[model samples]
Target chain A: MCTCNKKNEYIPYPAKIESVKKESFDTKTFRVRFTDKNLAESFQYKQGQFMEVSILGVGEAPISITSSPSRKGFLEFNIRATGKVTDAIHALKKGDALYLRGPYGNSFPLEELKGKNLYFIAGGIGLAPLRSLINMVMDNRDDFKHVKILYGAKTPADMCFADELEVWKKIPDTEVWLTVDKPCDAWGCSIGVVTELWKETDVHPENAVAIVCGPAIMIKFVTLALKKSGFAGKDIIMTLERYMKCGIGKCGHCNIAGKFVCTDGPVFSYEQVKAFPEKEHVI
Target chain B: MSKMIEKKKIKGLLKEAVKQWHTYVPQKHIGGDVLIAPLPEEAKELEAALDNISLADDDLVISPKDIFFPQLETMFKFKKGEIAETVESSPKLLFGIKSCDLKGILFADEFFKRDFEDAYYLSRANERLIVVIGCINPPRPGACFCTSAKTGPFAEKGFDLQLVDNGESYFVETGSEKGEEFVAKYSGFFQDESGDAEKAVNSIKAKAEKAVELKIEFQKALDLMANDDFIPEEKYKRIGERCVYCGACVYTCPTCTCFNVFDNAKGDEGTRVRIWDACIFEGYTREASGHNPRNQKWLMACRRYEHKLKYDKAKTNMSGCVGCGRCLASCPVDIGMSKFVQEITEDKKIM
Candidate 1:
């Protein structure tokens, strides 16, 4: 089959930063809209799926969609200026042009979690992906049971979506418990790791699905805490972070124990993470 | 009828073939390594500079991986935030490739197609014409065991044409439409010798089959490691400790298709290119926030073996190890797939 022709899969579409909101000191939430009207209108992705934000000369990195699917027209990414591409992203403001490819990785099984109470646990920039699913579930709040959010950050200055956490707390039929690793005048919340908050909160692990996202070390203790809190291995869902060069599965950078985090998951069950060695993945 | 190409006129045959296609032949470098490169034009003035090149030597140190998935190639040329241009590729001929390396090409194809089709690789692969030469006489020369992997000594299919050196001439078997067209165009260079081709090929195949020296328990090891049916012991830790992560085995592997893409930008104008990457490197799967998933050398080492014996098998139903023994050949630490499998399987408790 001599069908070999010029095919460039790495081609990215232009997206202009519609707006930028300072989420935290190191993190900024950028509202990006595809320059093409049709693309902007048609691009729909589930929670836990991410997009590749390309900073012209810097490179590309997989940024999980921070906005819910219900929030139409524009996509949101909460980027922490940690690496080269991200540092360049931090330099951009309103109307700045960037390139984007994909809404990749498998999404959370929203259908499976239907009728079950949701326990969302996030810390720092880890709250970005969970924010998408959080809002989506909130939009469809009547379908699900009780919704609880137990989130923590390194410090009050490091917390993202403080206003939204307050907004979610005010919503009836939902519980939001916020915490910081250390005390601050701005953050009027408990001081401890996110896992320690599990003991302080009331959670029905039997009918509740526990979703966690944060640093690797935090996830380790969090999973252990969740297991001790009566959550089954399969019941604890977490999205992973890795150095993704190609947002697609072609690049070997994001593979962990034969699983390509770019495609197979950015979202995996605690059981899946446990099957691989503790050192082989950032759960 | 199988076609025969006379041995003396082979160079002339290659010279004529080069005019039609970008033909690559295995040539010896000054350092005694056989390298695969395009046939040089016959510059009458510097003819003495080139040595007498032959196709029927040991297989080249590098496989066809470089031909399709090159070490460095531009994926796309971008301007600021948009792609300005894409690179065009030419049709190519890989001449004198052995069966194992041919299988390696197939493995690479499967790898590129998984999850996301590798555009850089598929573009080059689409324009490729493979001509396999059956290595039956000496079977293989330096560290080879294609037979155990059920890949070679001879290839039955998946090539444009298959050739066998019958001492004085080559018995050619065209396997595709492109091959048939080539045979028709170069009819003068070949003669029908199919009547004796079968008998001659079988004798060579038999000798080569018996000559393969590698005897690692590949399938046994694969089954043990599959689904964590058997966990490897302390030896794996030592194997990982000994590994310097130099990535020699990855570079030389015939079936390894891992890669990483980066951009070379000059201001706002630059190109995005994908370079060869190895899982053995700790940084390969490390996160941006300085958190590495596979922090241990033992885990990287474990991933390599699992990919060879477990993962690729589940994906393609084909053996990841071509048994070309390049991993064993190029590994500086003296630990390769063969050694890894032998040690792990030697005392593994399957229960």
Candidate 2:
């Protein structure tokens, strides 16, 4: 039996929105700071983790932390306004308050990717989680080798973090490749799916680790492409997205087989992911 | 210290218990089924409810799961965008809980305390005073196989107080200091025994063990499950076809601890509630983008048993299915833990 004396992890700390920037047609980036200065300064987390954002009356939804911890004070959540809670969040202004909890779920093992070349493949809104790691690696550029990022969306209009993409491209020793499935007048890149961009890279499989995130169908194709090119399942890491509640493992909604996605991982290697029961686990 | 209370003095003991605690006892409901429920609020309903109050009533119609892990619990409230916690006003006293039911509570306690401690469950479970009475010849004998699960016909470890029947009087033994304090509170009802205490208790246990009619080869079933010597898919498919997904088995189960959290906000006020969730439901694991992992009914059915027999045992050294037999009793399809395990361990011809 475990101790019941620890602080209740469910309690949400109040965060006031400092700024809200629209990233895509549906997604917006909300920069929030804890109401208490002490908590805002003390809170810390790693890349690829998420927080439960609540709208008091509407509900709560798990959104990835888009900002790296290296950027001190305040947090950014790239939320897609799809459901009720998110729609309520979209309606709020810069000065409104929202309940926040977490920095929950496992993160990318930084030590494993330290000396290896990093390949980032993201599509659609899947770029939200991967953006955290891309920034973190850039902040500690001396510890890593060559970094390549492959990003694709339905069209130029669907792309998120347009300003950040420019800054990412300007980072020294980093390669940025952008593509759109449908060619648009404003876009300045090749036209193909996210996996197709991998064909342009010649990074050796032995010395490189690929990080991937996308829809279930997109992940399947990307994983198959990586495996066909001799990348072992252990070397490929992706942050899995599941419908999460409690952020903690207590609420069993995030369970895949007996594995609680919220606790064991929202991030897993291809080896760990293939073990889920077929009926309940996709990607 | 050990003591005995005659069968005639049972009501007096219960009447006194009601005064000190939020008392619940095995009593006959208006429908004549014996259930463990709080003493009715109205005196008008008391007679019907207490008609069959005894140590030897039929294995309760519903197990005592809802007492702690409420089927629908308002965990916290959000008023004016600020969260407020809910507190319990009085602790609960579950009186006349049978041995099998006691083990069920113990299993729930361990499950809720795994990796993360559930404050909603622990707050109620911690302050609860369990007074379990041993089941010697359970009336619903054909429905339960608790002896095979190694949980009961009698409890050995978890309850605060245990009572055993020895002909004219009831033998009382305190399993915790709380039980000893409770005994002192009503000292007039107890009588110090003169005979060999251990021998007498052992005799009652032996008699009770013999009375258990249903037996399952639980270890063999576990081996078959571990080895993947599964029964035919069609058998499970048939069960899936018949199951209506009513979730009665989950609600009545002693150790099922799956729950869902949702915020119910209206106007400027709302509450975040944690409610019971059954794996069989389509909504349990469906993603916002409309992808479902356990979409098939057969998959949910498979997960349910594997959770009870394999996962719980591996994690906690306790079977998720304590063989309380509530699933068998409540499931409309009659496909539950007992039937599934029996199929795994028994011959195909016999099945």
Top candidate (DockQ)? 1
Clashing pairs in 2: A279-B293, A280-B293
The DockQ score of candidate 2 comes to 0.49
DockQ of model 1, rounded to 2 decimals: 0.53
Query: For residues B85-137, could you state the per-residue lDDT of candidate 2 as single tens digits?
Result: 76344668888887778888887777777776677777776676888888878
Can you list each candidate's DockQ? 0.53, 0.49
In candidate 1, which residue ranges exceed 4 Å CA deviation? A1-7, A277-283, B40-52, B85-87, B137-142, B227-231, B347-351
lDDT of 2 at A146: 88
Model 2 C-alpha lDDT per residue in residues A140-256, reported as the tens digit of each score: 998888888888899888889989888988988788888889987867787989877867766457789999998877888888998988999998998888878777887777877
How well is each residue in B1-351 modelled by candidate 1, as lDDT tens digits?
Answer: 667788877766677787767777777778878877776666651243235465774757887689887878777777646676464567788888888889999888888876577666777677768889988643234457666677778888899998877788877878899989888888888777747678887887787677777666777777776766365446667778888889988988888877877889898788888788898887887777887767878878777877888877877778788878887778776777777767777875211
Residue-level error in angstroms, candidate 1, position A241: 1.4
